[model samples]
Target: MFDPQTQDQPLPQRLTRTLIIGAVVILVAIGGFTLIRDQFTEEEPPPPEPSAAPSPQATAQPTAPAGGDNLAQVDDWFPHSRTEFAEAGGVAADFAADVATIDYTRDDWDSHAERLGQWATDPYAVTLTTADGVAEGIWRALANDADAWTGSADVVEVTYFDPTSVTIVVQVQAEPDTGEDPTDLGEFSVDLTTNEGPGWRVDRAELLR
Candidate 1:
């Protein structure tokens, strides 16, 4: 029994079906949009902080020793001169003057001998047994000659020096006993030792040709 009137639904039923279909399509569109938006979006990371520079106070610095630069000041361990005779120049000058001031005619040979004795020591002292010995030798040599003889010694240089001792090189010039011209005795090297009591004294002498 198919009837043309029944085939055409009622208006209220058609309206309800239409409203339900439209609601389903809207829900589907909203779900798909939410999924797509979530897939494309991302959480951003935090920015990096700047590094700090080194400060002058953080650097290592060199410092001097506790004694306040020990190398800059001289220590007591080093030897020092306490007397004038310990000085090389003064001792050398005195020795040269004594050697050149000998006069055979001067009756005061004792004074010359005493001065020489004061300057000489050990081996040189043995060379001149007594102050008179030096005078006698020179007197014997100048007895026959009447010419005025003069002797002079020039300190050429100080070869070596220390707190205890010094060596000097000297050039000696003397007028001949024959009244001839002065002659050079070449150079002489003398070693002297320092004494606490007597100061500096000659221990050895050598004629360096």
Candidate 2:
């Protein structure tokens, strides 16, 4: 009688077969991931930015003269004398003189001429006309020089500036001469800005014949 016996694989052979199958599955999964990598990737670069611009700044401005400058202007008015500057206005005498006067008093003769000269010469000549008594008559004393300048003198002065305008004020001394002397000692001056800058002129003068 033949016994029924089936052939069986060895334990070592079975183990080797299972290991080979697992290695094959792992290799397939790695290859699949490599192929699909691009689909899972991020390709967008960050948005570009614009550069910033520069900012602006403020500039500086100039200033005016001092309380003494007006006196300096008056000083400029002296010396030229009525004969030399009959046309310049705002002289004190335009109101009183029958004719603009002349500075004929001996240069050594003290008082009016000396006082006025001294006062007007000071850039800081704000001592009060009653200080020299000639600030008002300076132009009148010089108007009588008929040979140098002529015509009726009008010591007219108008506001050249205003505190409302740039915080500075200017007064125009406009005296046109009358070839003769004024009857009274007519002299006057007005106080305005202390300094002389920013288009402000001193007591500029002129003579006409």
Residue-wise C-alpha lDDT for candidate 1, range 46-134, written one tens digit per residue: 77877787665865678877777665554444454434423655565566545555565663555665666677775666565453343
Task: Note the Cα lDDT for every prediction shown.
Answer: 0.63, 0.38
Off by over 4 Å in 1: 1-87, 107-114, 130-148, 176-180, 196-198
Instruction: Judge candidate 1 against the unseen true structure and give its global Cα lDDT, from 0 to 1.
Output: 0.63
RMSD of 2: 16.3
Which candidate leads in TM-score?
A: 1
> Candidate 2 regions off by >4 Å?
1-32, 35-40, 45-98, 101-209
**Candidate 2 CA-lDDT value:** 0.38
TM-score for each predicted model, relative to the true structure? 0.45, 0.24
